[model samples]
Target: MLRVSIAQISPDGTKEENADKVEALIRMARGADLIVFPEYSLGARLEHADRLAEPVDGPLIRRLAAAARESGLAVIMGILESAEGGPYNSVVLMANGDAIVAHRKILLFDALGSIESRYVRPGNMPLTLVRLGEFTVGLATCFELRFPEIFRSLAAAGADLFVVPAAWYAGNLKEEQWLVSAASRAMENVAYLVAADSAARAFVGRSLVVNPWGHVELDLGKGERLVAWEISRDAVDEARSALPLIEMANQHMGTWARVRRIY
Candidate 1:
């Protein structure tokens, strides 16, 4: 069984305040194998363009690395990254003080009231896959959830589990979108879906675990909470055996392409 912890808490503008909250939750995890955190929940700087990105050796990632090494834990954390003259939204995966992968968010949310495009650079890499013991883990951020192609790429790369760390904004029926997207992704790819959402006033929290069979194994309500669940590797195989969506997906391949010029 693989144990997972989701930290669903609102974040303040101060780094110390956010880090303290995360540290408290990390300590509560106890024996969890993987712990997931929400996007930009370490500090609220959605409007700030300059002070976003921190180096791998910087305080943001360094702090997470220390926690991982001390607790023998694996973490999937979302942080704003600064690069050259621009900032980027990224998910950094760490294990035992080592960063295994850094997936820069490809889809930037600039439409409507979002100014992400002004500060952040759009990523070009496809969904990145990381090996975790016996299973391959996949990654995707908040806005990336709207695109099914990224998920398909990860599934094609042999990912058995998908981790989504998001600060999903609240809306009239946004919760439904989360439910549908999670279930559909799991069912379509026959993989486990673990989502960590922020419980801030602007962002609704509802961290969840969905099995390959599209079942909700764990659900954290719209409140600040620490939720954990165990999943079996055999369950992944059994789901794929019963419904071979992974194999069937090959028939509908080559449909999505990278956007060359944004309008």
Candidate 2:
């Protein structure tokens, strides 16, 4: 069994304050194997994000890495990545005081009158999957949840669990959309989905965990808190065995069969 902690943070202070919240959350979830945080949880600066952007080896990331390692916990969280062209929105999975995988957000949040595309560059690179205990984990950011294609591709690429760190904006029907999207993605791919959302003033805090059977396991409704849930690979196996969606698609020999993409 793998224990995962979800840290739903709505930071209301300076950079130091945000870091303190992260440390406090990690300390609170000391026995969890892994912990996830929302986007912009590190710097407390969601707007004008480029100003506080940093490389993976920068001080902020290093400090976070050390803190998680010190707690004997693996962490996956979002940050603004520094680059010459695209200071991308990225997620880092860290262990042993080092980053194991950094996944940039492929889809920018350009909807709902929020033009993230204006400041952040879209991650054109392929998605990266991280290794957890007996599970292949796929990483995505806020806006990616709107696109089922990305989730489908991740499922095809051998990912059994989806880890999403979202900063979802509060607006008409947005909260319902968040819940539906979480359940839909899990049912469509027959994989577990974990959503860690920011409960900031502008954001509607409804972090969710959906099982492979499209069941909502846990939902943190409108608050800043940390919660844990235990999952096992046997659950994934049971879902796939019942659904057999992957089994139906991957058996054909198409010309582009090298990647095993489902139509």
Candidate 3:
């Protein structure tokens, strides 16, 4: 079993404040095997994101790596990655004081009048899957959750757990959408889904963890909090055996071969 902790925090405009929150959460979740933070947890506002950008190996990430090593817990968090064209909203997975995997946001939020594309560059990288303890984990950022194809691809790549770091905006029925989408993904793929969302003022604060059976194991409501839950590969296996969706899909690949070719 892998013990996971989710840190839901409202990061301000300063990197120092965000780093302090991460350190505090790490100390609080002392025995967890992995801890995840929300997207843009390094403090980047849409208007002035350039000022908050940092290289992958910048001081902020280095401090996070050191903290992960010291706490003996793997850390997954999002930050603004300084790049050639523009900053990419990316997430890094840190273990043993080093970054093992990084994923840039493929689906930028350009539909909500937020104009994320104006400040951040879109990424075209492949899905990142890494071994974390007994689980093969897949990483995805905020807007990527709306795309089911990404989750399907990760499942095909043998991911047992999907860790999503999101800074989901709060408006309309967005809260309901977040929960439904998370549960749907977990059930469809028969995999555990762990989503850590920001509790920032304008964003939704309900961070959640869904089991392979589509059961909500942990949900941190609209406030800053740290929640921990136990996840096991056995649960994933059991869910798959019960549903048999993935197994059937694999067995009947020829059915979709023509569709894939056409698409």
Candidate 4:
């Protein structure tokens, strides 16, 4: 079993303030094997993303790495990244005092009164997976959760857990969509899904953790919260053994490939 803590906090336009909050949360998350923070945890608003964007090796990431190393815990959180074309919505996984992997947001949230493409560049990089103490964790950010294909690809690459750091926008049925998508991704991939979302007014704060069987082990409402739970590898094995969905998919992948080529 892997002990994990999720920190759901509202991020403002102040990076230092947000960093302080992250430090406080890490202090509260003592003894956890893995700690997660919501997207925009580095304090980048949509309109001001470009101004706040920083490189992966910037001060914020360095501070987070230091915290992870000091606490002896792996960390996952979202931030705006300065890139060649523009800023990118990105997430980084920190362990052993370094960034082991970083995933840029592929599916930018361009709808619902917000235009991410204007300030955020869409990434074309492949999915990233990292090992965290008996778990191979896949990384995704925000809108990527809406695309099951991304999750399927990660599962095919042997990810046992999916971590999503999101600043999901609030709207009609938005919260419901968040819950359903998280549960669906967990069940279909037969992997644990842990999503930490921002609690800001413009975003939904319903951070959640789902088991391989589609059970919501933990769910936080519209408030700032720090919660911890254990995820069992045995449970994942049991679910796959019982359902065999992934196994069946693997078996027929060749046939599907042939059909796709023929078409």
What TM-score does prediction 1 earn?
0.90
- Per-residue CA lDDT of model 3 for 54-135, tens digit only, reads 7878777788788889999999998888877788899988898897437999889998778799999987688899898989
Considering only N, C-alpha and C atoms within 3 Å, which residue pairs clash in candidate 1?
Answer: 53-81, 53-82
lDDT of 1 by residue, 84-162 (tens): 6676788878887876346888888765477677777887566788777667899998877778888888998899999
lDDT for model 4: 0.86
Whole-model Cα lDDT of every candidate shown, in order:
0.79, 0.84, 0.87, 0.86
TM-score for candidate 3, please give it. 0.95
Which candidate order results from sorting by lDDT in descending order?
A: 3, 4, 2, 1
**lDDT score, residue 46, model 3?**
70
lDDT of 4 at 213: 89
Clashing residue pairs, backbone N/CA/C < 3 A, model 3: none
Say what the RMSD of model 4 is.
2.1
Number of clashing pairs per prediction, in order = 2, 0, 0, 0
Predicted candidate 3, C-alpha RMSD: 2.3
- Tell me each candidate's TM-score: 0.90, 0.92, 0.95, 0.94
Candidate 1 achieves a global lDDT of: 0.79
lDDT of 2 by residue, 228-256 (tens): 99988899999999997655655652644
**Candidate 1 deviant stretches above 4 angstroms:** 251-263
1-263: candidate 4 lDDT, tens digit per residue = 89999999988748777878887788678799999999878775778887777677877778878888888898898988778778888887888888743798888888777778888888878888888888899999888899999998999889989999998888899989999999999999999999999988988898999999898999988888999999999998888899888778888888887644455
